[model samples]
Target: MNILIKSATLPDGTRADLAIADGVFVESAGSGATVIDADGLQALPGLVDLHTHLREPGFEQSETVLTGSRAAAAGGFTAVFAMANTSPVQDTAGVVEQVWSLGEQHGYVTVRPIGAVTIGLAGERLSEIGAMARSRAAVRVFSDDGKCVHDALLMRRALEYVSTFDGVVAQHAQEPRLTEGAQMNEGPLASELGLAGWPAVAEESIIARDVLLADAVGARLHVCHVSTAGSVEIVRWAKARGIQVTAEVTPHHLLLTEQLASGYDARFKVNPPLRRDEDVAALRAALADGTIDIVATDHAPHPVESKEAAWAEASFGMVGLESALSVVQSAMVDTGLLGWSDVARVLSSAPAAIGRLAGYDTPFAVGAPAHLTLVDPSARSVFSVDHLHGRSVNSPYLGRELPGRVVTTIHRGVPTVLDGVLRDPQEVSRG
Candidate 1:
């Protein structure tokens, strides 16, 4: 399908009437192409998610790659890097390549499978990073996400080993000792609620140490789901000292606070947990000034049974794919700290850069891959879990109001979502 995006401005302060033909952006339009009016919408290269949990090849009861890709399209994401924490753990080249094949079979969005840093994410032994890298999947990012790589010597070797292949270690930065049995962020709230205390130092200490280690080994480091003010300081300090480190803040962490734990709702039970309002303020400022490199949804999905259990026994996640773009649009754009271009940068450009997908976040320009999102920034909508395209409905933002709905999503010049509904990817065959 051919696409025509009208009245969109590029981040470099230039405006264009973008045209796509046969899966590539063209300088000029052909007369036979189908055209969609994009008068009030801001068009950008499609969004890329650096962190997502699409539980397939095992946990399909929670989510599959197809369903998660639909959720991603609905959320204005053109591509997503599936995390290594799947049922079989995505540690081997076979598993990683299978995931890449599944993404192709679905063909809704690009799915880059992240290789597990340690076997089964066990942390004691390193996985076949070399084999995974050399596989057809060509996994470029490795992480022990959902579990911190606690051993410093092991982490150093993993970092050094991946450096040979130009890969970065995405750290989940949490000290196991400091967060054992921890339910929420440690402080007044944990005390008042009588929940296990997860102190900020648990996260900050890991980040502080990892950045220094990255500097020592001359390797790149990426921090995932940064949740504390001190962690922000660590990333800032590392960057100032010319260390190669990048950080991402979750949309929920930027918007919500630890006070939500007072309700004892399992929906608010995230891995890092909600933090203080002061930290929220600090995160917002950091994102505004580029201290935070990007905003990742973390987009974890769990079944209803897992979330409906007692607060302490519940799962550690909430679905954010469908709500991410709108929340970022509302919080960042509405506040005037960022514009539509900045939204594309955080949600699309920078994420692709971090994940090392060359064409994933290309601009809507000539010869670029026609991966794009058309968003009506003025559109306001009420959040309803049932309306989300994902199989899971664990979003904490349910019932909340947000602005800027993604009206259309074009992947590889094909309209995967039209008028805010998912199109059958297989129905539209490739040329």
Candidate 2:
């Protein structure tokens, strides 16, 4: 396979043609080589998702590795770190290996499985983290997502346990005590709506405790979906104190607020819940000034029936893979808080570095993996379900107008998406 992307803006502020051969990027092409005009599009490093629940190995009705990877490709992602909170939980070497192998079988993008922090994500005991890490899957990021590892002593032990192998625990920071029976952010909105109060302190306290614990244990800590301004303050303080803690704010948290859920729709019900506009501004500033290291889509996919229920009865997530970049481009780029390089850094590079993945986040140069996203920022678009590739139509941004469509996405020099359409996986896979 060979392609010459003509006259695209490179990350280094130069416009040049990128030539690819057999899925590995070759040098610039000579005159009259088989080429596709980028029409002066801004070529970017392919996006990476640090947190995504593919829902395969269980809950196939919601998604499979095939459909999820297809969704990822359509979303301009070259790789996604699959969350371990599956049916059985990716707590063992066998399960992680199976998920990894299935990703290869699909051959659309890299699907790295996260290992559960405790048995079955129960938080009862330390999972076989070392064993899972030692497997062919080489799981490095462990999490008890969808459930916080709230036991202080156990969390301390888990933090120390992963340190021996350079593993980092990605915690879903919420104090079970504070969030017990809670549905939305604790505020007047909850009072008016007659919903349970999931307080900001629920998130802040866990982040504070984990930061202290990480400081005490000298291990790395990652706060998943840091929502509240209080939580942001904690992360900001931790980083200033050199506490070795990093935080990520989802695209929803950066854009939407509790007001969206006033409709009482299930799609707006996400864990850590949508926060206030001030927190959203703070998070965007944090991303700009390096307070938040990555902007990952907590791309949780829920089945239609599960999400289409009453707000409280429905699942606490929304499919984000397909809409993440557009949301960022609309909310961040359109607002002047971020540039194209900053976009790549947060969406592609920083997340890969934090998640400890392989072969992603590379600069576009000779000998680098040819993962790329060709963007048409001038392209006006709408979030139509007909254009969505994910099995679940649970994205919160449906019917919203947005900018920056991904016209072409190349994974390892092969076009998984050409002209904004998902190509046949078999045609793109390396033989």
Candidate 3:
């Protein structure tokens, strides 16, 4: 199929007409192409999420690749790196290939599976890192995301092992000992609310240690969902020294603060729990300055029952894929801290570079993959369950007004979304 997108504003503030045919951009539209009037919209490279939890092959109650991919499409993403915290865990070549195959069949978004750093995520022994990397999925990233790779010696060994294949170890930087039984961010509010506190140092301590380890071994390391001011400073220091370290900040961390915890609403409960206002400020600044390499959703979704529990017993995640771009626009672009080009770098280009996903950084050029998103920048809406395309209804932005609704998303020359509505792939296939 061929498509013509007319009068769209590029991220660099230039207006142009874009054409796609047979899944690649072209100089002009082919005959009988589907014409779309993209006037008053901004065209951006399709987003790529480095951290997304598509709970399949085990926790289908929460989300599956098919459902999660729809959520990603709704959020204007062309690709997302699925985290390895699934049933049986994505620790082997077979599991990674299964996930990769599911993504291909869905066709909603490209799903790259991240292999687990340790077998069973036990942090004791390394998994089949080389085999997974060499598998059909071509896994280029390994992580123990829900659980930290706590043992120092084991972490170092895993880092060195992946360096052999140019793979990066994305560590979930939390010290288990310090955060045991923690419920919310450690502070005066936690004490007043009578909930357990998760200290910032718990996350900061592990990040500091891992950055040094990465420098010592000359291995690539990626920090996931960095949530503290201290952690930001550490990452900045490592980068200044030319350490091969890249970091990601979640949308929740950028827009929401620990103050939301006062209501005891379980929807706000998240891993490495939301930090203070100062931490949010630091994260925004770091992202704008290029100290933080990318903006990852950490798009964890839980079932209704799982999230409805008491704060102490609730799950530690929120559905984020569908609302990531709007949150970024509200938090970064609308505030004048970043422009559209910066959003493209953090959301699309930089993440692609870090994950080593080919052909994504060259967006909207001739012969490149025709993966792009069209946004109505002036459109504003109150986010509600109607906007959610996933199985889970645990979005943190529910009831919050967000800017810049995604008008359309084209993946490989196919329209997954049009006119703010998601297209059913089955219906399109039948046509």
Candidate 4:
């Protein structure tokens, strides 16, 4: 599919014409090209998500690779790293390869399978990391995301094992002991609501321990869903010490607070539960100053029954892939804390670098793969379930008004979404 986009604003705020041909950017679209007038739209490098839960090979009721890929494309992402906590757990080479093959077959977005740090995520023994790394999937990131790698020795061993293959361990920094039976962020609010508190130290302590372990072994470490101010400070300190660590903050953590839990709305409930307003402020500041590496959608989706239960019995996640960019724009860009270039960095290139996915270093370069999204920044509307393209509508931004709308998203030279509408899956597959 050949495409020519005219008058689109680049990340650096420059207006230019972009021509795509044969799955790569070219000097011209040549003959019989589809021309799109991109006036008043921003053309950004395709976004990449480091943390996403596509529950396939087991829990299709929640989300499948194809449905999740459609959600990702609707949200302006061209690639996403599927978490390891699937039904069967993505621990072995065969499972990872299966996921890779599914992504290829669907062709909605690049689905890079994240291998598990421990077998079945039990945290007892290390999984077949080497085989998965060398498999067709070539898994570069291993994690026990839904559960923390709480054992220090096991954590160290996992880090060392992945470092041998130049892979990084993305840790879910939650101390199991401190967060047992916890429901919301630990504070006065939790006490008043008669719920167990998930203390900040639970997250901070694990991070503090892992950064030192990573330093001792000289292995790369990545922290997932950092939600507190203390966690931010610890990551900042680690980076200052020149430790090889990268951290991600989810969109919910940046824009929402634990106060929303007062209503017992399970949609606001998430792992490493939302913290105080001060923590949100600190997270925004850290992201602006580069203390936080990137914005990742911990895009967890669950069935209506799972989320409609009591607060304590409800699932710990929110569907985020459909609302990540709008939330980022509201929390970071609209606040003057970040620019479009910074957005491109946090949402695209930086995450691609972390996952070791290439073709993003020189965005929109001639002959580069045509992976990009066109967004209308001036558009504003109340977010509703209609915006969600996934199977489950468990989003937290349902009634909120958000800035920016994805106008068109092209992945590998094919239009997954165009003119603000998601293309039919069969059409995308054919293209």
Clashes of 3: 0
- The CA lDDT of each predicted structure is 0.88, 0.87, 0.94, 0.94
Tell me the alpha-carbon RMSD of every candidate: 1.4, 1.5, 0.9, 0.9
What is candidate 4's local distance difference test score?
0.94
Model 2 misplaced regions, further than 4 Å:
29-34, 429-431
> Which ten contiguous residues of candidate 4 have the minimum total lDDT?
422-431
**lDDT ranking, high to low:** 4, 3, 1, 2
Off by over 4 Å in 1: 9-15, 360-362
Q: Count clashing pairs, candidate 4.
A: 0
Model 4 error, position 226 (Å): 0.5
What lDDT tens digits, residue by residue, belong to model 4 across residues 1-431?
A: 78999999999999999999889999999988999999999999999999999999799999999999999999999999999998789999999999999998898899999999999999999999999999999999999999999999999998899889789999999999999999999999999999999999999999999999999999999999999999999999999999999999999999999999999999989998989999999999999999999999999999999999999999999999989999999999999999999999999999999999988889899989899999999999999999998989889898899999999999988888999999864585466
**Candidate 3 residue pairs that clash:** none
Model 1 TM-score relative to the real fold:
0.97
Model 2: per-residue Cα lDDT over 1-431, one tens digit each: 67899899875567887898667677865555557788758888899998988998888888888889999999899988899888878999999999999998887888889999999988898999999999988888999999999999999999999889888999999888888888988889999999998889888888999999999999999999989888888898999899989889899998999998799998999998998888898888898888999988988887889998988888899888888888898888889999888989999988888878766646666787888889888887778897679788899988998887888988877888988888976775533
lDDT of 2: 0.87
* Candidate 4: residue 58 lDDT (0-100): 95
TM-score of each: 0.97, 0.97, 0.99, 0.99
- Would you list the clashing residue pairs of candidate 2? none
Winner by lDDT between candidate 3 and candidate 1: 3
Q: Which residue runs of candidate 4 sit more than 4 Å off their true CA positions? A: 425-431
Please estimate how well model 3 matches the true structure, expressed as its whole-model Cα lDDT.
Answer: 0.94
lDDT of 1 by residue, 276-336 (tens): 9999989888888899989999999999999998888999998998888888876777888
